[model samples]
Target: MKNNFSHFLASLIAVPVGLIFWVLSSNIFDIHLFLDVLVGIGGFGASYLPTQQIFHKKHLDKYKLTNSEYKYIKEQLNQADEQIKRLRSSYMNIRTIKDAKMIYEINRIIKTIISSVEEEPRKFYRGQQFFHSNLESAVNTIEKYLYLYKMPGKSKQERMQLHETRLSLLELKRTLQSNLSHMNASSYDDLDVERELIKRNADRSKKRQALLTNKLDKEKINLKKDQAKEYVYRGDKNGE
Candidate 1:
């Protein structure tokens, strides 16, 4: 919508272009109506968003996706982002510690998927697929359960249903967690490698510093030994 010169140009040209084609065909053949319609469609197609969507959009480059994949994945990512936003709205209304923790984990997973795609799209795409599969159902299930829990005056059956729903949501959360566990494990391995690198550098630095200190101490001791011999020789000469 922002820089839609094509649409504006189409709006300006379509009528004149259609009319010109109509007049030319009217003189040239009896198929003026068909020509007019064809030109009109061509103008509209040029101005359509789908045409623009397939073009090499620079912003989508960050995700490292092809034009088609960019469109598809961007749509899915937007849906998940919206769901995460809605879930955040319920933070203050959360009742139990367990529910809060569940929400935190879900947000963590969603945010990680979003970040990982920008940095490492290939590695994070599996997480993206998992998100697409679960996001809508998980949102509905959690929100519906929370809504029911908040509403007053539940019958015995409704109470029973609430408990069942809670169990189901718990199971769903656990399922999502299980799928994300492998991703978390890979991250932990990366952290371990980084930790070892830092430790090795620190060890090297300490050893270098200790070696310099030892060398300086030996030089000082040798200087003192040489000075003592000179003093004894000068004292014997004075006695003579």
Candidate 2:
């Protein structure tokens, strides 16, 4: 919202700056009105485009997103936001605390996935199931469950359906968790690789240090032996 507002404010400033430029150019140079209008539009664009670029560049830098990635992620976010709203509506119809908590947990997981995807757009691809199908399915299932739950009287079959729906929701929650784990699997892999590298380097360093220590110890032993021989020779020569 703040970023959008900045663009809007920049546009407002640009309009006036453009008009001023147009007026100045026309009066000073006595240019044609068509040229003046063109200059005005150009001025507006020049002013607004830079501001937009600056804001967009900052946004891209913050998320490390390419323009295409940002646009795709934004589209996905919009769709997710609409689905989440529907999901929340189902929450309002929930009757039991247990069911409410379940819905809350699902919502929490979906939001966490969204937040992760927002920070790293590449995760959207990894979490396509949650972002694309599972989320919408969750909304539909919850709403259907709640609708059946609030019926005047549930038949044995309807109650059984409800039971299955509940189970399905639980399974869906687990699936969402799996999706999140999938999204972060690469990060975990990277961490594991780094840990292995560090361990190898540390072991190598320790070996090098140990070898150096052993060499120094051998040198010291040899030096001591040489010193003792020299002392014996000096004492024997002095006695002679």
Candidate 3:
């Protein structure tokens, strides 16, 4: 092979090059210098060969993922994308000051999740675990926000908005939990279930978004209808 030939050539050249340097130094100054040069060359060769072999092995191994593993990884990536989309949509719709703070915390959590999913496979499990921890923290923050918003004295509109936002937060919590479960269950050979889980989670998120959007639209329409009815009632009373 070309690689073997190159290694052979390198070894051949290294000995002669080392010897040439030794001779030149000896001729100019001292024999001890030549002996020290030879010792140095020996030490270099001893360290270099094993290091080169290890590096070569690692490099070759990096490209050898099983097809199923690759598919599973791709599925996880898709799940991450879906999560980001949902987070961005939810963040844009956030209205109240309390909800805005929750959005900020969710944004941080989503960023961590995205980073973990993008990390090299060699580092994935650890990175994903850290991401899951952040997600839990985000969930706790949302729970606290929901609790604070549930107190007395809120306008009807505020209460409705809080209820919808709380629903979104619960959906997010479910998605995170599903993702963490998949990450924990994943392995080299049996990733089929993990892939399915991710796909299912993404599907659930899409459904949740659709439901939230529809509900928000309905609420807006109902509010307009109620205002129109109130105006009509007042006009009829005045005419009477």
Question: CA lDDT of each candidate?
Answer: 0.68, 0.86, 0.60
Cα distance off (Å), candidate 2, residue 210:
1.3
Q: How many residue pairs clash in each candidate?
A: 0, 0, 0
Models sorted by lDDT, best on top: 2, 1, 3
Per-residue lDDT of model 3, residues 171-228, tens digit only: 6755665554454454433578778889999999999999999999999999999999
TM-score for all predictions?
Answer: 0.59, 0.72, 0.31
Number of the predicted model whose lDDT against the real structure is largest: 2
Best by TM-score: 2
Better of 1 and 2 by lDDT: 2
Clashing pairs in 2: none
**The 10-residue segment with the lowest total lDDT in model 1:** 1-10
Pick out the ten consecutive residues of candidate 2 with the lowest summed lDDT: 1-10
Off by over 4 Å in 1: 1-72, 85-109, 115-120, 150-153, 175-181
Candidate 2 per-residue C-alpha lDDT over 86-203 given as tens digits, one digit per residue, 9 for 90 to 100: 8877766778889988989989999999888866777788888787789889889889898889887779998998999999999999999999999999989999999999999999
Q: Write down the lDDT that model 3 would get.
A: 0.60
